[model samples]
Target: MRDRVTEAVPELVAAAVAAPSMHNAQPWRFVHHTESGVLSLYGDPDRTLPVGDPEHRGLHLGCGAGLFNLRVAAAHRGWDAVAETFPDRRDPWRLADVMLEESGTGPSDRALADLFPAVENRHTSRAPFTDEQIPPEIFDELCAAALLEGARLAVPSGWHADDLVDLVHDAELHEAASDLMQAEIIAWTRTGRAGEGPETEGVPAYAFGPRQHDVKVPVRDFGLPRNTERRATATFEERPQLAVLGTEADTPADWLRAGQAMERILLEATRDGLATSMMSQPLEWPELRSMARDPASGLGFVHMVFRLGYGPAAAATPRRPVADVLTVV
Candidate 1:
């Protein structure tokens, strides 16, 4: 079993690295223990966002994406991945341990298998979406995808969408105006370039998606001061579709679930021929994060704000090589 398990290591790491991250910052690591067919997922503390994601929202999102990828790879290889969060009570950084099982229910694997193709194709589209509403049925499917991963996607209506747009714009302005936040944004954007620095994984310049003539969907200007004057015209559309991803709890485990659910829903949407972009601006502030939830919906904790619709697909961002992220122990 050790040799057999070792053979799956490369594929597992490849799938994990395929997970969507905030600005493509693949800030997670994989350690395979050959003695026990247990793959440990760890967060790269050095890659954490100190100012922007103080509570590790982005960190969890990045790791969750990796987890989703791991599941997909496992399913593709005809194996079942039994994951336990914080398997060790003493080690907080020990995120999870994935035990491989050969014979098991195919439900999870089936779903992940369906999403396998989207692993490489799914990306964050920063460009404006056409003023087209995603079909209600497709929306329902996406909602189901989140629910399967223990999360919920709340699609806001007319007034709700408008209000969220305002909240996002306000939060974006606040974050952008602050020097500390601005510096962090610059760091991630600049570091996004391949081989630029140690922080090699992040949203790359090419995937910044052409800048809009005027802000449309509350995109964080990655090249704010450096290329503020550059023109990458986008046809801003009115009434962008808005959906919020929420969890039942707000613990580290819940965050990890929410993050993986996010990628699952995003990939499902991408497979359904929809373009997507996520904005955590409103969730950045406590008050604003609360506002993102709908009282009528009975969901109080919101983890992510996603925009979905038909539009141009954004370019793929750069990613760190598999060799750099995977290590055997």
Candidate 2:
């Protein structure tokens, strides 16, 4: 195939792995075929939360975000990467395959390359945002970004937003009362003080964001095991901004598209000087997930929930080195 999957692709993989994963598990694996020049992405079964994602939907979303980053990296490098969402019908774990090569001018390439800067800066801001309102134009732009990836961004209105908030609280209560969910949180979070040591993955105690003293913060509280003495309680903003990312279907391919769309929306928001965080608590539960979307909007499947606004950027979480996640054969 003469694909240009060369020695330098690992460096590009660095940017791909930076895409956020559930609990920073970073479950996706990339294998580059030296001779065929085929780079394949697979979801690591070892890194999963069975209780929360028995279907591995969250893992697929993370992998899709990483795949989007890979495409952007390839575009920035002047390489046209041909991607197949699922190359094998029988292999459920295989997520995607990419063949990298040079190509002539294409609008898609330029469009993806343009997002390189946002990809570099997009982050999950667990902190509170100001009560300022986002302009209508920005909302339209975000919706357009999602549409580009074949997904929909639903911005809930007055009553719907309140309904979503209540649903989120209900999901939180469900998780809090469940031992398995709490175990998963404890398994993937660090309890040590901030900057305690070098960690390649997992949500650190520092990123937990201040314990929400106010009842309205949409950010998930990761202090379930309760490290009360070390963590501080900071009042979160009232009337926090929220949105939902959805796909037309609930299949693996749909989840991948949703993930890419989620990242695109987040990057666009970042470029517009907005801080972003995710609230998948409601979406993790089937009953709660269904209630998250507005029946009036007729949105299909809600893949992710976004908290967006003007605020301080959250600290960058650690990611595995490119070598750890990529295998060369």
Candidate 3:
């Protein structure tokens, strides 16, 4: 059993690293206790976006997404992964500990195992999506997905959705005016020519998608003044189908749960043949994040805003090699 667990560590970490992160930072580390059959997750302090994610909320979210992917990958490999978050208070960087138990009968989480196919297929679609309505039933499935991970998915409509879009616009303007924020974005974005060689992390120029002709939707603009000629212009959905993923409290654990929920929704959306992109612009600022939630909905803190529709598949972002992030003992 111990040997089996050790052998599965590489494949598991590879799937976990495939998860989305802020600017593709991939801010996570994994360690396998070969003797105990335990896999541990840690947040890499160096990979954090200090300016954009000052409180480490986004960092926790990214790690949580990786955790969820780890769970799914384990399930696919016929192991029941029991995860505990923030296992050690003394080590703040230690995020979660997952004990891999062999499933004697079958996969413990068939639902999670079913999502393994979508794990590799899921990519953040920054490109424009067609203006078509997603069925209400699909929204229900997504909401259930979030709830399963201890979070809520709220679909904002009418004036509420419009208000969220305005908040994103406000955040964009705020980012534009703040030199520190702009510098942080530029640092994580690659705008080099084709022959410049590939980056192992960060959003490359090809994945930036086209610049929106209008501000109908809140797609982030990563293009700097130096790369103006490289980006093409296109129109995005006028009234994008937006949903907010939130939790009752804003703590590290809550952030982690929200991250897991967010990834679950993204994977489920991918399975349903929908294109998806996330908007954290508004949620990055405290005031804007507060304004993002619906008072009537009773959601305390908003973590991420999702734009979902039918659009072209997005270009895959780069991820660090597994050898750099995993350790075994």
Which candidate comes out best when scored by lDDT?
A: 3
Q: For model 1, which pairs clash?
A: 23-202, 23-203
Task: TM-score each candidate.
Answer: 0.94, 0.95, 0.96
**In order, what lDDT does every prediction score?**
0.80, 0.85, 0.90
lDDT winner, 1 or 2: 2
Error of 1 at 191 (Å): 8.2
Runs in model 1 lying further than 4 Å from the true structure: 191-200
lDDT of 3: 0.90
What are the per-residue Cα lDDT tens digits for candidate 3 across 1-329?
Answer: 77888888999999999999998888999988877888999999989898899999999999999999999998998888899899999999999999988765553388899999999999988788988899999999999999999999999998899999999899988998889998888778877755433399888888888888885787887785335675788998878999999999999999999999999999999999999999999988887889999999879999999999999988789999999999987
Question: Regarding TM-score, does 2 or 3 come out ahead?
Answer: 3
Clashes of each: 2, 0, 0
TM-score of 1: 0.94
lDDT string for model 2 (1-329, tens) is 25445766796688788898888889899999888888899989988879888899999999999988888888888888788988998988889998888855888788888888877788788777888999989999999999999999989879998988898899989998998998887778876656433477888877888777777877888875665556677777789788888887899999998888888887789889999999899888998888887877768889998888999977788888888889999
lDDT of 1 by residue, 1-329 (tens): 56877897888888788777665667788888878879999888878877778888778877987898888878777777789987898976778899887846657678787778888888788877888778899989989988989988899887777788888888877886888887777777752345355545666666676776766576666766456555477767777788888887888888899988998998899999998888887788777888887887766588888988888877776677777877787
TM-score preference between candidates 1 and 2, better one: 2
**Residues forming the 10-long window of minimal summed lDDT in candidate 2:** 190-199
Native-to-model Cα distance after best TM-score fit, residue 4 in candidate 2, in Å: 5.4
Error of 3 at 165 (Å): 0.5
